[model samples]
Target: MTEALATLSRAYRMRVYPTRDQARLLAQLVGASRHVWNWSLAKRTSAYRERGERLNWVSLSREFTEYRRDPERPWLATLPREPFNQVLRDQERAFANFFAKRAAYPRFERRGGRASMRFTFDQRRQQVRDTGGRWATVDLPSLGSLKLRRTEALNGRLRSITLSRDSAGRWHGAITADGISRPAIHVPELDAVGLDAGLRDLLVIADGHGTRRVPAPKALASKQARLRRYQRQQSRQIAAQMRAQGLDPTKPCPKGVRLGSSNRRRKTQQQIGRLHAQVADLRRDALHQASAAVVREAQVIGIEDLAVKAMSRGMGRKAFRRSVADAALGELRRQLTYKAGWRGRTLVAVNRFYPSSKTCGACGAIHAALKLKERRWACPACGTEHDRDENAARNLRTEALRLIAASSPATPRSGESDARGEAAAAVGRTGPAGLSTSANREPTVAGSGAKADRRQRQSRPRKTRTDRVAVGSG
Candidate 1:
């Protein structure tokens, strides 16, 4: 097993910029590919409707070739078979995934706008230039002698290359390879860290070392503003174009507008899309770095599996949604899992129900109530003050460590696990009414009967002063 594991490899992708002619060829390839995809999809849909099951790519390609020979479909002959084959393969995968419940029904690819193509290499001869300098002799099919700017070092056997165009009118090639090794693990002491993800701060890390705040990049906000401005400009231009064309400018335009008439609007839309893509790329890069840092430094990393969907159902839903989208907490978790696995580090997840925020870190006592508005609080039991975010981070770290200890062969000698078990049992003794208390009561007297009494009094109706006065007068 160890030998097989040692033989196992890794894969990485690097973006490469191509020359102008290469970009044009890429665009043409993408258009032809999309055209092939649409035509094949239409034929397959028709066939499936008439004769159960869709036709295979080979058969379809043969038929397409015959159709191309016909004078009526000369445009089909002009289409590149390589891209057509690629599209057919993509459609096949899409259909297979849809049937497997892995993805939704395949959507038709848009033609000509942002062209792309894929290249696959055998296990051997996968090596390509990566000198960070322009290549003079690299060969690309149908587009020869293309200059490429290498962004990152390539490792292992090259498997595939996918070339795509950005909305910024830039061309990029993604080189996929195999046989890469996992990054070296930086094993630290069994110190665990908890992260609280938020809008104001990207991540709040808490550990035995102390609390630290990692703020989101200012560039994210700036790029978002730029994207919005571009989008607004594009919208106005599109509206004006619609008005000039004797169409209802307010109504949504159809999928492909008259090319020449809406050229400028289309260009603006592309610019806006490019800006969005840039922002997304920036966020993804940041997330990778942050996740890698945590995975490298911590022996065990614990984070909340926050139900972002449920949390978004609030008064300020847009803001919450934006926060969730910006943080990409789920993506962070994903990266941590895979990266940790590679490094043989532990990635622990605290239960969503865990009251990390409400729980006092200094004491084991859980706060009965903690609102989002409260940024800081003092633990009544321990008399320990805490920044709310920091408190949550501490709680997460402790809980994660506890979880890891319980799951591992090495149990703590202090019987903390036994105490925790007893505490959990005690929680169960309080019943359903008790659950509400923890979710709603104040931090000071969380589990006390006084809280229950106060809640009851609060729920009950009070007699009016006028009624009391009338009774006294009578």
Candidate 2:
């Protein structure tokens, strides 16, 4: 049997530079859409509570259409209604997710946060056009052509584009497209490597050649002092201003007394936002480069399915948790997942409990009592010394290769020995039979696409990213 040609919906985030008037209009557009969402939500709540009526997106949109068309509300009539339609569609999905227990109930869109609007591609308006080179132009539903910049030219059919305003007052657009060409496959299938993620070392990669380590980039730590100073200065400025207004600095302000804003305060806040964004950009840039390097070289990449949240909770020190978060371990894996899929490489996720650290790479010896502090140790069965991270990486590569072989169309897995299925659902929890560190039942064979049953939702064969990294640096 032949495998189907795979396709992906890739999204790109580009910087958008809008004129003064366009910026004001963009703000109005997002504000109007927000108003509609809040109003529709209120209407739905009232209908359900008072008249026992349920209102979906269609019904809410119909009412909004009539409401906006009234001569009394010229403010709503001037703006294009297409973006609001997307808002309604999003609201509908939100409600559906809530009912299905996938998300919380839809909330009202408020002011003074990240303002955004979604516009579907319509050829004339709401289209993305590449002028030439790295520069492009985007036309939202109502906003005229806005200057845009990206590393690569827009290719294939433009699906829909979403524009947003961040706290720093910068404009950005996320353009979704279809049929875009992915990176070419150049490596052999046997070129597999294992990646171990940690705070001490960003990544310890093991391959046929040897083991290599990448140092961790503690981006936040580098700027921690600056961030703390800014925060303290902001706090002190606020308290001083409040005290000047004859209000208690320590206690909450009275409802009637409003603390006014100043250019100084606003400037301080924006500076903080810029710093935070810089740190994030630095971290993300590093992750992208690392993942790209890994994906470009290897055909099969094995990685641990790290439970970062659980791992963070186990750490007693705030600094430890902060370090774990700044490392962006999960983000690295996410990048690897999509990049590998795009580049025609295979990314295999080893179960977290796989004892990669405890198991010996040279000999299959399990050191149950291995401590976390022991960075280097010798195998009990064979006296070969090993670096903990390097050993773990080698083990992961072996497990990933085994799983891939077992899941192959030629393997014909059956009965109780499906290594791929076990890698997906079991194997890590327990050791060998009697010597098992943890005991558990055998997992069922995991198929490509699972459908929803009575209790749980369907499982997907693979989880791939819909967004691709920028072709060049931000």
TM-score of 1: 0.40
Count backbone overlaps in model 1.
Answer: 1
Number of backbone collisions per candidate, in order? 1, 0
Give lDDT tens digits, candidate 2, residues 1-474: 222244446788899999999999988998898888898889988987899987888778889889999998799999988888998898889888987999987787778854898888876544566788888897665688889999776776688889899989898998998776555767453468988876566688999888898765777456644655676778788888899998888876677887888888888888777766665566567778888999778767877754334433423334443444424555665566556645556666666667888999888889999987798999988999999989999998887766666654233235433443333333223211111122222212222211111112222344431211111100
Write model 1 residue lDDT over 345-408, tens digit each, in one string.
5555566567888898888788777666778888878988889888888888887766654442
Candidate 1 has its poorest 10 consecutive residues by lDDT at 465-474
Question: lDDT score, residue 175, model 2?
Answer: 90
Task: Please list all clashing residue pairs in model 2, or write none if there are none.
Answer: none
List the global CA lDDT of all models: 0.60, 0.68
Error of 2 at 163 (Å): 0.6
Candidate 2: worst-modelled 10 consecutive residues by lDDT: 465-474
